[model samples]
Target chain A: AQTVTQSQPEMSVQEAETVTLSCTYDTSENNYYLFWYKQPPSRQMILVIRQEAYKQQNATENRFSVNFQKAAKSFSLKISDSQLGDTAMYFCAFMKGTGANSKLTFGKGITLSVRP
Target chain B: DVKVTQSSRYLVKRTGEKVFLECVQDMDHENMFWYRQDPGLGLRLIYFSYDVKMKEKGDIPEGYSVSREKKERFSLILESASTNQTSMYLCASRRWYEQYFGPGTRLTVT
Candidate 1:
């Protein structure tokens, strides 16, 4: 069984500042997918960003990006110029296969607070 | 653009009651999942359905069961609700990479 771990239980950052959330996983599969999901107070889980283990270039989506180190089993999410809307619980998820049938393993989560 | 809807936003039931939490997806997705979220525990998959009428037990299926008579609808059932079963239940549907989620149903068993 693969496990995703987010060591931080809570994190806070000033608005417009940069913040990084750390995540690590245990998996034997070489080709895999990683994701960062945000759950706001409304409780809807939204996809923030994703990374493919095979890609060394890292993934960038606007101000959201990932530092994926497959060799170290680490996948971290970095949010730049953080805003108030970014306050939410962030989850790190792992997937080993493609398509709808693939199962996802998620970390406990880190609650991020963006202070004004 | 993708929509996943749950039957209720909040539900309170008595212990030993047969509890049903319904979920419906609009994308006609082939895969549906039920997960329970708790404080500091993240989300634990209860069940997943890949096709109509086909169900698979996930990590935490001991006190839960699932039904999927149609491709768009997946239901989670608690045979006998217990106090320990109180938590927020989230439903999701996916066609390939991204999973679209519903506004979860918060269920409480007294």
Candidate 2:
């Protein structure tokens, strides 16, 4: 069985600052994928960034990036230049590399608050 | 961009009533998933459909059922609505690699 854990239940960051949300997972599978998702007040879950197990370099998308330590099963998301719009629920997810049989396992999200 | 749509944004039902939550995708994705989001627990997969007429039981599938008659549409069914079943239901469609989610349906049972 695979499980994802988000240690921080809540976090706060000032505008134009940076914040890091921690995530760890337990999986025995060799090939897998990790992801970060943002759910705004609109109730929509949007993909933020994704990292593949085979890749050693972390994934980056604009102001968001990930520090994926595959050996330690850690995949943390970093938000740079935070804005008020970044206030939302952030969830970390995991899935095996299998094509059709892949099912996402998510952690108990962390609520991010961006203050002015 | 991929777009997933759910039938309702909010739904209310009685304890013994049957509930149906519909989800449709416009990108013709091969995989559709149904997940439930609780406060302390992020999201748990209830069911997943890889193709038309092909369904798989996810981690939590105790009181849920699913139908995938068409490639682009997937439906989640609750045989008996209960208060414990009241949660945010999310639909997602996966293609190539990333999964696109729909604006969840918040269902409450009384």
**Over 4 Å off, model 2:** none
Give candidate 1 regions above 4 Å deviation: none
The CAPRI category of model 2 is: high
Best by DockQ: 2
Candidate 2 backbone collisions, by pair: none
Best TM-score among the predictions, by candidate number: 1
In candidate 1 the C-alpha lDDT for residue B13 amounts to: 100
lDDT of 2 at B48: 97
Q: Candidate 1, which CAPRI tier?
A: medium
Per-candidate interface DockQ score: 0.76, 0.81
RMSD of each: 0.9, 1.0
lDDT scores of the candidates, listed in order: 0.93, 0.94
Estimate, for each residue in A50-108, the C-alpha lDDT of model 2 and write its tens digit: 99899999999999999999889999999999999999999999988859888888999
Our model 1 lands, by Cα RMSD against the true structure, at 0.9
Would you list the clashing residue pairs of candidate 1?
Answer: none
